[model samples]
Target: MDNNLTDRSFWKAFWESRIGLIFNIKRDYIFGDMLGKIKAKKGYQTAIELGGFPGYYTIYLKKYENMDTTLFDYFVHQGLVNELLEVNGLKETDIDIIEADLFSYQPETQYDMVLSFGLIEHFKDTKAIIATHLPFLKDNGTLFITLPNFKSINGWVQRKFDLENYNKHYIESMNPALLASYCKELGLKDVESYYHGKFSMWLENKGTQSALAKAFVKSLWFTGKVFTKIFPFESKALSPYIVLKATK
Candidate 1:
């Protein structure tokens, strides 16, 4: 059974917005720092990102870590993925593309790294969904997962301003401690999970918003950027993402 809370149309509209064009220094910093830590552990050569479409993170893995990466997605939005690759000065051949469903598809070979960003939280069965990625990872290979921390201030903003978007995510799976517990329960070694970014009002909604609400959100976003710049820190209440790292 397809357990995805989000459907193809949601992804299609999401990719069409081209929100990646807007750059956030804080977001980049948090992601880059995490990747650096992963790189420090070992030199990973090959990686596969499950449910990764329009492959921005995979591009970063290639450019920064010099990993041969593969993007595995259903390709319901293939045109947008192709366009993104072209815009990034990459051809379709530059990165391996696998069109498959995450729940049932089996990889031909395992990889040094198996990752997914903001993917698993859409499913109702968090542990079951996470276990599906393990088969694609080689022994001692790293498993990295990141999901929006919707149990924080950002959650409040999302719930109030974008209830529709908030409802799509499985809130029970948003806890860092719970994520860590799940990884450990799956028999992964050295499991670690924690709140990631300091603060950010980043929302995935590109839909219409009230002028007052937009201004309020923007104010909070600006304040968060300035505050994080001065004192970079993350806590359960303020952080925007939860990162989980483990080894198979």
Candidate 2:
């Protein structure tokens, strides 16, 4: 882990850049909603975020919710940890840092929420990937999962523009429905799915694209927003990402 990544100077620079803007949008739209639901529920005590590198979402949740938080990742990015703590006005003791792989790791106790983002899609066995986390959740605990939906128009655009890490995704057909089915198979009740992230937000984070490509994306921003506003239902269906909320 690069210390520079968490250093206040580097964070300040990135926070002022377009990538930071994208991150803020993602956090607000994704984490904000999910954490709101978590806090709304009864008996919400602790949350454990798997694959929480840099823990941006975890940090945000910690700021609002009065619960014990834990971050589990195979590799520890100390810079991200420090940056999150400092930015969120949290201390080292405020959150637990665990260095462990999900496959072989088991918790001594369960949490009120077991969360993971952009994780299960990387493995061939998505079922087992999710099942592995079951033991870490308390009875009636919520399991939240978010992944890139490669079946939408946003997916086609990302592919056409070569803006995604295709090789990193084990399957091309990942969607909320498929994930919901997995939860059902595992006997998880009250499953729900949502689509989020329009083209403009996706393009904003694609900071490495060519100048002409960026200009093309910029042109579509207003049109996309207008289309989404007029056809909100359709827009959600064509959104770039999927989030699954289920009870264990």
- Residues 156-212 of candidate 1: C-alpha lDDT, one tens digit per residue: 999998898899899999988888888999999989899887897666663478788
TM-scores for every predicted model? 0.89, 0.81
Clash pairs (backbone) in predicted model 2 = none
Predicted candidate 2 versus true structure: per-residue lDDT over 163-238, tens digit per residue: 4445446554376677788889999999997776654335434667889888876676667778878776634446
Candidate 2 stretches greater than 4 Å from native: 1-29, 171-173, 197-205, 234-237
Candidate 1: residue 19 Cα off by (Å): 4.6
The lDDT values for all models are: 0.81, 0.70
* Candidate 2: C-alpha RMSD after superposition: 6.0
| Pairs in clash, predicted candidate 1 | none
Question: What stretches of model 1 exceed 4 Å from their correct place?
Answer: 17-30, 225-231
Error of 1 at 95 (Å): 0.5
Worst 10 residues of 2 by lDDT: 1-10
